[model samples]
Each structure stands twice: as structure tokens, then as C-alpha cells.
Target: MPAESEFTVTPYSVDGNVDYEQLLNQFGADKLTADQRKRFPDPTHPLVRREVFYAERNLDPFLAAANSGDDHALVTGRGPSGPMHIGHIFPFYFARYLQRAAGTTVYIPFSDDEKYLLKDQSIESISDHTRENLRDLLAVGFDPKRTRIVVDSADADVVYPVASALGKEITQATVDATYGDPENVGLSFYPAVQATHLLLPQLVEGRQPTLVPIAVDQDPHVRVCRDVAGKERHDVEKPGALLSKFLPSLDGPGKMSSSDDTPSILLSDDRETIREKIQTHAYSGGQTSVAKHREQGGNPDVDVAYLLLYYFFEKDDQRVQRLAQEYRDGSLLTGELKQLAAATIADFLEGHQQRREQLGPLHTELQPYRLTDEERRQALQTIGYPDDSLARQDSE
Candidate 1:
């Protein structure tokens, strides 16, 4: 771990000991206050309740819309760079909770184009990953009527035109400042595309408060979109953000990454694989010797096994507290905690995998979730293409 103040966090990478509170200051986001939490529909998701999702910018309008049963939506996206992992699924599940609780419309965008530009991969490779990723996303069980999944390349009819309009508002200097200099022109243009993703819900459904729930590292993307929405030309409210800490990696405390030497628990891991991985690779907070651990109480705060449960797997608050206490006093052995987390995580994945298996052909299952022709037209029209504005003129 780097020194307390030595960390670096950006939309692309995170390193060292991240001071999350300091990040809020650096990013100009506020803490997710108690008053704001109170306004959420009953049975708030543990991600929010446990402060796993701990910060915000412009959250109230969305909350007001949620409470009053008015129009509201959430945009949570995926980058199909590789197979989905445990860390990759948090925001999707969190969004599902909001959808169930408040009837919130959900828009999921797969930035395959961004991944292609950023990674040394081909379009075919990205497409393969996109199809697999769509399966995992489908397992989360969002309502088809209220949810729309947009793939940047596949949906470019709407995405490209909308992004082109917003691109005029976002300068190269702004993109350079927010994300650093572009490695490629596609990346330079991606911030505008990202703004298109965030604002698309309102663009299609008419102006409504939209909330983007994402890890704190992604806040810059939201800030860029908010800046564009503030411009006079776009008829949209700035999307709000609900930011969260990086999910802890299996090896230790820093952000989880597939690039890390320690293998991540993929969404496809079976019960045995999950157990073996947890028992072998999970970082321990206990003493070197069982006797010493019993004598001197372990620190649950840094334990990967315990943190996984606290972060998502264990929903029963009292049980989690009890386990933490037991672990602190050495009543809960580190192996026992690992066993418990492996089982809990396996249970969650069991259902997810079952749903995935039950799903029909990928293209067929994905159909209902794709934007309808009318929706694509509405989105394009909102960005100034009325009835395919140019095509109509050309035909005449």
C-alpha cells in the first residue's frame, strides 16, 4: 500500500492507499448524507445503506422524482473488454435494486467501441465479449419494459448523431484535462459518446431526472456530461451521480482489477472454484498463528473474506455485525470466515448462473431490451434530427 496521501485515482486506473473522503473533495462530490438516504424507497439496497455507495452530486432531484412516482431513470454501463467479474456486477445489481424499489427506468450501455480503442483487441473480440456480457446482465432480471440496453457500435444510428451534437460543446482541451491526452482519436471523441450514454434516457423518454450510479473513479464522465447539459442547446437536466468506493480486490485493499496477479472471482465461477479461490488467495487479517490470533483479536477491516460479506454477500445486518464481532474476538476463525463468504457468494452466483442457462438464444433474449425504432427516432429527434431530418429533406 502506498502512503496515506500517495494514492492516484482516475477514470482509467487507481493505485495506492485511496483516501475516499479526500477523493470527494478532489472530485467536488458530497458525502451521501443521512437525510438523503432517508428519502430512498423502503428497504434501501445494502450498497447504499452500508455506505458502500457513499457519495453524490445532484442526488435530490432524482430522489424527489423517485418519491413522488414521477419520471426518473438510471444509467449504469459496462465496458466489454473481457468476461465479467464479481467487481463488475455491483453497479448493475445496485441499479436493479433501485428499479425494483422505485420503478426507476434503467439504461445499460455497453461501450464496446471504447474498449476497442483502449485495448489492443479487434472488433470481433470485443463483439464476442459483448455477447457474453449481455448474458450476465440479463441474469440480473430488470424489467424489459422499463430497461433499455444500448451497444455503442450496434446503436450508432442514435449514439453517433447524438454524440456528434454534444461533441460541439465539449472541446479537446476539456477532454484532455478530464481524461488526459487521447491515445487515439476514438478516445478523444468518446467523452462525447459517454455524455450521449448518460443523457440518452432523458433524450428518449423526455426530460426527467437521471441518476448514474458508478464507482467514484467514473465521476469525471458524469461531470463532463453535466457540463454539456448545462449548455443552452441541450434540453436536458444534468444527470446526478451516486458514487462508490472501489470494491476490494481478493488479494488486499486496493481496487479489484483483472490485471492484478491475484485471480478475480469471475461471475462464472462454480461453488468449488469459488471456495478454492477464497481459501487460497483471500488476504487474511488474522495473526500468523491461530494461538496468536485467538489471543490478540484479528482486524476484520482488512480481511478480504469479511469485506466481501460486508460489501455485498451478507444481507442480514445483524448477522454481519455478529460475524465481525466474532472475528474480532477470534471466535470466528479466518478459514471459517472464508468458508462462509465462499458459500454466500456461491449461492448468489448459483441463481445468476441458473438464469443465464435458462436464457434462450442471445439475440432473441436481447431483442426486448434493445431500443425500439420509435425510441431511436425520439432520441435522435431530441438532439435535433426531426423525422430523420436530413433524410426527409433529401427525399423531398
Candidate 2:
């Protein structure tokens, strides 16, 4: 394993001494507070209560909107470049929970075009992942009326024009600095698409507080979008950001990492498969021998099994703490810890799979969540071309 002492977190890379608090300082985002968490609709999500999502940018407005029964929305996106995994679904679930709790509108944008531009894949290949990812997203069971799932390529009518408007505000220098040199123009222009994704709800329904929940490294995209919203004369509010730490992968403590050798646990894994993966691959912080482990105890901080539960799967805080205490004192074995974590994660997958299996044909189920023609027109018009603003004229 590479030393964790040195790390770098960019829009495209994350490694080494993450130091999330220092990240907050560097990114100019505020740490999430307990009181702010209480403002969530109800039954506060584990991600929030446990501080998995630990920082925010201008969240007071969103909190006020959620609590005051006013207009609010959330933007959580996925880049469809590969298969869906346990780590990819948390934000979608969080968005669903918020929508259910507060009646908040949710916008989920699948950046197929961006993935195509960045990856060594064809557009057709990216489309395949998009369809597969969309299925996983649809299974999250968001309200069709309140949730909008936009495949950027499919929604280009609105996405393109709006992105053009936002693109005007992003300079090549900014793109290079935020994401490094783009291999192509499409990649260079993706920041605008990202901005459009963040601001789409407002463009469609008029200005409202929008919170974008994402990993912290992705903050630069939100920052770029916020800058456009601030600089442009458009009638929009700067989108707020809700940032999270990377979920621990089966391999180790740092964000779920996958190398050529290690593979992530796909959402399609069966219970037995999940158990085998965790037991065989999960990193352990236990002592070398049984006697030594029992005498010296295990380290939960670096134990992938314990971190997995502490991160998301284990809901009962007290129970999680007990597992940690037992591990620390050598009462809990690494195998036992792995079994517990595997079971907890598999239980989550079981419920998710049940919902997924119950899904109807993708196109049919996705229809209600797609942007309406009127919405597309309004979004396009709001950015410019008031001629198509008929859909938004009354809403104005």
C-alpha cells in the first residue's frame, strides 16, 4: 500500500492524507454542525447524523427553506462511466430521503457526455452505462413529480443552450486549473454542463435554494457554477454544496479505491458474494496472530470492516460504538468484524435489490422523472431566448 502520509484531492484524483477539516479550510466550506443537522426534515439520515457528509457552502438558506416549507431542491449527479457500486448510491438515497422528508424537488443529472469526453470509451459504450446507471437510480424510488432525471445528451435541447450561457462565463484558465488540461473541447466545456445541472431546478421552476450533495473534491465544479450564477445577470441563486467524505472501499480506509487488482463491490452482488469479498479482500488492522490480536486488540480506525459500518451501513450509533470498543479491546476478531460489516451491507443491498427487481421497464418508469418539454423550454429561455419563455412566463 502506498503511504497515506501524502495525499492529493483534485476534481479527478483523491489520494493520501485527506485531512477533510483542512479541506474545508482550503475549499472555503463550513463544517456541518449538529444543530444544522436537526433542521433536516425528520429521522435525520445516517450520512448527516454521523457526519459522513461533513461540510457545506451557504446551507442556511436551504435549511431555512426546508424547515419553512418553502421551495428547495437538491442536485446529486453521477458520471456514467462504469457499473454502479455501493459507494455510488448513497447520495441518490440521501436525495430521496430529503425529498420524502421535505417535499424537496430533486434533480439528478447523468453526465454521459462528460464521461465519454474524459474516458477512453465510445459514446455508445457510455450510453450503455447510462442506461444501466439510470436503472439503479430509478430504483431509488424518488417522487416522479418532484424528481427530474436528466441524461445530459438526451436533454441537450435545454442543457446545451443553458450550458452555452454558463460556458461564456468559464475561462479556459479556470477549466485547466480546476480539472487540468482537457483532452478535447467537450471535456473543456463540461464545467458548463455541470453548472447547468446545478442550476436547472431554478431555471425550470424559478429561483429556490438548491443544495448539491457531493464528494469534497467535486467542490470545484460547484464553485465554478456558483461563480457563473453570481456573475451572470440571470435570475438564479448560487447553489449550495453538501460535501461528503469518500466511502471506504473493501480494500482500505481511504475512499473506496479500485486499482487494476482490487475491484469494488458491485450493487448486483449476492449476499454470499458480498460476504466472500469482504472476508477475502477487506483490509484488517488486527494483530498478526490470534493470541497477539486477542492480547493487543484491533484498530478500528484502519479496519475496513469497522470503517464500513461506521461510515454508513450501521444505523445504531450505540451498537457501532460497542463493535468498536470490543474490537479495540480484542474481544472482536477481524473475521467477526468482517462478517458483521458484510451482513449489514448485504442487508442494505437486499432491500435495494428488492426495490430494483420490482422496477418496471426502464423507459416507462423513467418517463415521469424526465424533464417536461415545457421545463426544457423554460430552462433554455431562462438562460436566454425569452421567446421560449412561455412556459415560465406565468411561473415568473
Candidate 3:
């Protein structure tokens, strides 16, 4: 392990003009009290929260769904637009933590081909990108066997049922209710596939509690899943949902998007790139001038450095606390804080790279696809896939 000191560093004088409190309020961090806020206080918001529901609408249904006592299966799908970044791992880590605590099973899907449609990338690139993304996900410490990984384009049989079931469940009324105006067939189809993935484990022999640790932006899909889960239970019997919040980009509250083309720190980023990005770009909620900062104190609520520390730095709680205190008192400068954050991030990516290297070729080969022919055939017939050879191949 690299010593903590080996990480990159940058220095900046604080300017008091930044409205840290307003920034936090805008991002919904205002819900926390001063002391409670201190635990996370900035960009590093906690992944887990007491109220784990899908959206602001329909709280009662989600609560009722939670009470169903059916085992929860965590589901997440990657677009495979590009390399997996630190932001990509946030929900995965949360799911891993939840699975360990609750002993629940997880289902991860590589929606590589979906990116081709959504991002306008070519379909030809999705297969290789999905494979690469899967390796990155495995390196994040997800167990291959315990977690079922599937590619959307490849597993037509497994995917078709869920898609068909979802289409049946999502009437025009439901589609209009959830997605105002349903303009695209792909929108309905994709949500159905996601809903099917959510319910698949429940149909399997060992039913488990299913939860999807995802960013809040993906809640729409989960809402669709919830709707389908209810219909499936009545029609076919299946499990429901559990959702998590999205991790913000290092730049701040917006989604950590791969297509944006702005510099994002990927798991594959080298030490120098990680350091430069953190030092140069990671948003800081600190002071503009060092003199004013010392007089007025640092704003812990919006500081990017503090946020990264809360999420990434596992040890040195006391040191982190001390940094917060100094920052709040305006004794610590934003430049020094940025340096610390860059270093911490560099260390984390380095460690991740080492673990990723250990995953090897067999791990890639072992990632779950759709069911075999016999299994796919049975499932397809059950779900009503016609005699499509590609679909048959998926069952095989």
C-alpha cells in the first residue's frame, strides 16, 4: 500500500464569496442538521439513508411492497459507454455492504447495447465495452457467482420474457402515469427488461431479498419495476424493490455521466491524471481568499475535499475530523485540502487497479449470461417467446 503522503497535492486561498449553505440546500443536503450534517457535510453524502423508497410519489405502495417479506434482489445495469469510474462503484459498494449485512443476493446487468441506443454509440462496440465494464465491476469486489451478470443484447430469451411481461403490465395508463408522454417504444421495452431482471431471481429456485443500489436518476426504471413486480406477483409471483441514491460527479450535483466528455476519474486512471483532475477540477466549496477564509471559517457543507474524504478515506477519522474543524475555522486553506483529496483518490484508484488485475480471464468467462438452451427454452415458452433461433440460443 502506498503511504498516504505519496498522493498528489494542490493549494488554494479561500474566497468567502461562495455560498456553501445555499449550494447544500439546492442539492437537498439541507435536510440534515448541523451536527448530523457534519458526518457527511459536503459532497461526500452517505449512500445509505433511513427512508429508502423509489420516489416522492407513491410512498404507501413502496412501503407496502417492502412489507411483502419476499426476498429482495439487487439489480443494476451499466450502459458500457466507456471505462468504469469511481462514481460507478458507489452504488456497487453500497450493494455489497447491504448484501453482507442482510445476506441478500444481487443481480448486475451489463446494458452495454442500451448505451448504443441511448448514447448513439454503435452496437458493434457494446460487446467489447460490456466485457471491459464487467471486469471493472468484478474488480470492485462483487463475487461472480453470487452476482448474476447479463448483457442486454446477448440474452434475448431471458430478456424477452421480462420485456414482454413489462409491456403487458405497463398499460397506456401506467406509461402516461410514469413517463408523461410515451413517445418511444424502446423506452417501454427497456423498462420492461429492467423490471424482468428485478423479478427473475424470485422465480428461480432460491428466492432472495432484492434491492437495487443505484443513483436517484435511475428511479424511473425502479418505479417501472415496482409496477411490474406487483403485476407479476398477481400473475406470476415475484419480488419487489430497494433503491439507493446516485453519487455526484467530482464536479458536483449533476450525474457522473460518461458521455459528457468532461474529465472523470476512472478506476483505470493513473496516479498523475487522478492528481491533476482533483487539484484542477474537483469542485470546492471553500473560501475565495485565504485572509477572508481564516476570518469567516471554511464551509464544511459544500467542500469537495471534505466530501471525498468522507467517502474514500477509511482510516484516520481523527485526522479527517481535525481537517474539518480547521476548514470550518478558516484555519485550513482550500489548496491544501484539494491536495489531500487528490492524493486520497490516487491511492484508492491504485488499489482498485491492483484488485482488477487479479480478476483474470476465467472470471471474465464465468460472468453469468442468460440461461442455457434447456433453461431458456423452458423460460421462453413460459414467457411466450416465439420460435426465434436467437431467443432459442439464449435459452440454451
Give the best candidate by lDDT.
1
TM-scores for every candidate against the unseen true structure: 0.98, 0.95, 0.74
lDDT of each: 0.93, 0.88, 0.59
Query: Candidate 1 or 2, higher lDDT?
Result: 1
User: What C-alpha lDDT does candidate 2 achieve relative to the native structure?
Assistant: 0.88
Residues 255-306, candidate 3: write the lDDT tens digits: 4556564578888888888788878877777767888888988775567667
Query: Model 2: residues >4 Å from true position, as ranges?
Result: 1-5, 258-260, 388-396
RMSD of each: 1.5, 3.1, 9.4
TM-score for candidate 3, residues paired by index: 0.74
Error of 3 at 117 (Å): 1.9
- Compared with the true structure, model 1 gives a TM-score of 0.98
lDDT of 1: 0.93
Worst lDDT run of 10 residues, candidate 2, spans: 253-262
lDDT of 1 at 286: 89
Q: Which is the better candidate, 1 or 3, if ranked by lDDT?
A: 1
- Taking the tens digit of each residue's C-alpha lDDT, what string does model 2 give over 15-99? 6768888888788899998899988877988899888999999998999999889999999999998889888888898898899
Stretches of candidate 1 exceeding 4 Å from the true structure: 389-396
